[model samples]
Target: MKKIVTLFAALTIITFLSACGGGEENADAEEKKTIRFGATSGPYSDMVTEAIAPLLEEKGYEVTNKEFTDYVQPNKALANGDLDANLFQHKIYLESFAEEHNLDLSEVIIVPTAPMGIYSSEYKDIESVETGSTMGIPNDPTNLARALIILEDEGLVTLKEDVDPLRASLNDIVENPKEIQFVEVEAGQLPRLVDSEDLSMVPGNYALAAEMDLLSALALEDMPDDYRNRVAVKTEDLDAQFAKDIKEVVESEEFEQIIDEKFEGFGKPQWMKEEE
Candidate 1:
């Protein structure tokens, strides 16, 4: 009886040790495989949580998504090793942010642009804005210039000779023959001012926040190749596989369907392949 009891105890001990070792191995395997991403609130980030992340998971990747509300934090987090990647900014914003913070950031993939739109509370169309009608645009340099270019493209004003996208401003308007009121307001405040002003050009993010429909705008931002939408990763971790996964996710048809569903014709994902 004593010998049988001793053999059973030994067997139980061996089984427990084997189980512990297996658990450690499984944990090691799981630790070896996870991709982290940071994103801001709203449609851009929503698209990731709803569509992109799941699609990547289907390909055997474990994904970690960090949701943030502010624009500045995600990039900072990526720089500080708090996040592995972010998907909320365009190339121009990323470059400006990196320059301001003196961080090395690299864009892994080009994503969609939430094109700027010109909306009005009073006027039905661009033609209705008569002489001396007031107009409001974002005061930020990049967006202000972008809005001006759209105004110029609509033949509502004329920019200075040889001024490209960067150099556009009220001073560039040489042919404001209509004497339209061009007011510069803070980007976030533009939507609020629309009710008081004749027309306003606000960022798409803010416009969406204000519950405004972008499809009703008189004119929209022209989509360009270098027009500022990209998925950013730390310069050191911008490995080929990371780039491949991001590109595949961004260009996938699943992403396109989400855009169409959520934006409801107000926004669209324009890609270079379609342009080509």
Candidate 2:
């Protein structure tokens, strides 16, 4: 009886050891196989849920998505290592924010982004904008410049000739032909400002989030490649496997099909339109 009991105890100990070893190996295999992707709670998040995550799953990755209501937290979370990746800001905003916050982040893949546009409730067309009308622009510097540039294109405002159009601010404006009084508003609030302000420059993502139609804009921006949003990760992770996977997924034909089917009117980047 004693000898039988000893044999059984030894067998139980061996099984427990083997199970522990297997668990460690399993954890090791999963180290970089799970992606923590973050984005603002809008079209970009939908893109991850509907387009990117599905493709990554097929390639044997487990993707976890987090949606933020604001622009600031997504990048901060990525820098803090709380997220493996994020998509929200364009190249200039991303670079500027990282520099200001002293965080090292980089753009991985540029996606089809919604172009910013001037929206209004009172004015039916750009030609009808009245003199001394109040206009709302984004308070953030990059977008403020972007908004001003679009105004310049429409011949409503003009910046100093030597200033980089992308970096132009209100002070750079040498001419306000319409005598427009531009009010700086938070970017997210511009959609609702349409009724309150004579002209509101709404970013594409915010306009879509507010269920505003892109085609109804008074005028759409001629967005540059620099102004288009991209998937961003830590600078150190730029060469990482998951970053490469994201780039591959974004550049895939299937992903492009998804964009065309759902994200209508979002102008494709120059690189995407190159082969056409």
| Model 2 steric clash pairs | none
Off by over 4 Å in 2: 1-27
Candidate 1 ranges with C-alpha deviation above 4 Å: 1-29, 265-276
TM-score of each: 0.83, 0.83
- Candidates in order have lDDT scores of 0.79, 0.92
Prediction 2 global C-alpha lDDT: 0.92
Q: How many residue pairs collide in each prediction?
A: 2, 0
Task: List pairs with backbone clashes in candidate 1.
Answer: 90-228, 91-228
Residue 14 accuracy (lDDT) in model 1 = 100
Using lDDT, give the best candidate's number.
2
Residues 1-276, candidate 1, lDDT per residue (tens digit)? 999999999999999999999999899657536778898887667767777788888878788889899999999999998887888887778998999999999988776657788888798888887889888888888888888888888888889888877757777788987798878878989988788888888777787778788787777777554664578888887774655777787777876677667665333335545643
